[model samples]
Target: MMQCYGKSRVLTPTVVAAAAFALNKNRSLRTQSEEVGALDSWKKLWDTGMTRWHQRDVYWVLQKYGDDYIHKESRVLVPLCGKTVDLAYLTTKAKEVIGVEGVLQAVKEFMQENPNLQMEAVGSRNGFDCFRGEKIWLLCGNFFHFGPAVAGKFDVIWDRAAMVAINPSDREEYVQVLGSVLKPGGVLLLSGYVRPKGDVKSGPPFTLNKDQVLHLFEHQPWVASVECIESVNDAFSNEAWYKRLILRWRFGGVVSEDIWAIHSKAK
Candidate 1:
């Protein structure tokens, strides 16, 4: 059964039991060899059409929570964005939406898929191909190389798959990079997956519990507060693609989808 927990509630036993089952089953799944943070690996995924993470429409989390932070004057940044239709949706609410992607293939696909957007090649910067639309800019290059200097600070950041897609060791650096581009008082809407207490390690879509997220941002001077707004236990049940991936990977265990609202301290 699907369960959604609010900020005031603690994790239930059902969630824990499901996670245990998932981790035990995942232990038998095939080991993944791809380096998740490597640009080449992402390029290969785009080349081979292995992007199961790509959703056709705006993500539900964004649809439900976006209006609270996004406004007509807001400048939003989306990291590790992979041809998501959400970028187009964000432009409707914000003044400008900038997406940083490592793979040119993915960026090209986004442009191709949204012809009505009318994006044009603006040129290149720091080896990144830049595409400009009415209220959107796609930067095709290394996400780590992007900073506030490249495009100024953003009022909001939408991180749906960026955090979980990288290695755990790189989390601190990821947080630092995110902090560098966010304006004071800006908000980050992060969506991630969490499993029960276990050591099963295969990933591109890694597990990151609420505690880990808090610890990562706790010591950061720019951070004001980190709050878990929602948690859904049966996160992928309704998505046929997620089910197919789970079956193909022999993954067992309850994975919960968590939404975090991380706020930057005001200046």
Candidate 2:
């Protein structure tokens, strides 16, 4: 069992907005624009104690799928992991766990939350501070700077809130980096939101439509297929609907060849 991060506190919308404004000058409204989106906005949210997105327990989607696909001794990677309790939960099940977070403060809070676990600075790589232990490794740096060489490859990838929380412009790069570290035939479990048509512009919790999800991985040779799609409830997407997208990577794939063969037969 892992140590709990204590109870969660509720914050008002006005307070959250005020903090965003006072803390980050780049973003004026609730969230940042895709092009001008800054990581400093998230850092401000963490420093100001406005992290309402943090969950009290394990995420519902993970609770539903982890046991079925993520087996014992499986290596797991959680990106942009901001003091997420899910990291600790994974440590209980997986042989090795790696968490990459852009904010240094979030990693510090996570270590403070788990006093029982021992953590030490392993070294610096790709301009990020890396910490390692027997079961877990936490890297404090830009998530994009991390790759297979920095963090090694993993069997499973968990995106509890990472994908939805990032800027739209960065989404493609995010997926690319994720694929680079994932082993062949690895599984990617994602939790995202589908909001009303206009709500996509209003986000740090960006709304992701089914078409967008499909299009994101449509031509990727690494993605074998989307295995499952399901609906669930989440605090961030309460007004909307939360969706889970499970993608399985191909092992020694020839997807391009298959596509070419089909097209040739049509001529």
Candidate 3:
């Protein structure tokens, strides 16, 4: 395991209980070790290459709707950015791009792969290890530790899978943190997955329905509006049970959608 500057603590009961519930839905049980450690569990997933969620290229959301909303020379923020190649892509269009990641291994791998980045360590800020370059800044630490003072304001926030990956218990605070860093009238490009009410447990790729999305945004005063630009009923996995459930729940089947909503932070 890669050494993290920050200490790893046992997962809180709330988070463990949530994880256990999700695990139970899949008919699996977590060992005592897995139950106690949140960071280690995620670190193990990345270390073992279990990161199927990691996209090879920039997300479809950016390809499709980014140009429409994100202006050239804008400052863009990517939350929970897992060394996705999208960071490099963003640098081409944006004047500056900031990415926040929790894992040290992901940060190291990203820097190692992208040799073009003229990176220099900027030391720590609010507990995050910070690095800066010509067009990019990579912060390695817990995303929750990032504050407006540390992260500064941004004109664009590319929230691909970050929201869904968070534990439900922390979502409201997560949303608040997001709102704080965004400059007023900034663009927030968001996307995630949703599914029919099934026997399956909740997930890191958590189910986020349209209504839930609306509710989440509306509650935040900074969010001016949420226009769900696209939605489609789609397949989840190749599992036999998953396929059958899609057919059974035809009216409200499982699906993943790209949300290209334009959020204007309150002026």
Position 206, candidate 2: lDDT: 73
Judged by lDDT against the true structure, how good is candidate 3?
Answer: 0.70
- Per-candidate TM equals 0.84, 0.73, 0.76
Candidate 2's C-alpha runs over 4 A off are 1-37, 233-267
By lDDT, the better pick of 1 and 2 is 1
Show model 3 residue runs off by greater than 4 Å: 1-36, 198-201, 235-254
Backbone clashes counted, model 3: 0
Q: Mind giving the per-residue lDDT tens digits that candidate 2 earns over 1-267? A: 121122222211222221221212232233334322467878888999988668777876567667866788799999989889888889888998999998888988988888666877878986779887668989988776577778778888888768878877768767767767777767777766654433556465677655566666544545555533454322333311122222102111111100000000000
Error of 2 at 232 (Å): 2.5
- How many backbone overlaps does candidate 1 show? 2
> What are the per-residue Cα lDDT tens digits for candidate 1 across 1-267?
232344432221222221232112223222333333377877888999998888887899888889998999999999999999999999899999999998888988999988888999999986678999989999987675677667889999999989989877767767877888889899989988875455327576788776788778766667777777888876667667767765535445656788888888787
Ranking by TM-score: 1, 3, 2
Model 2 alpha-carbon miss at residue 194, Å: 1.1
Q: Model 1: which residue pairs collide?
A: 22-252, 22-253
Worst 10 residues of 2 by lDDT: 257-266
The TM-score obtained by model 1 is: 0.84
Candidate 3 or 2, higher TM-score: 3
Better of 1 and 2 by TM-score: 1
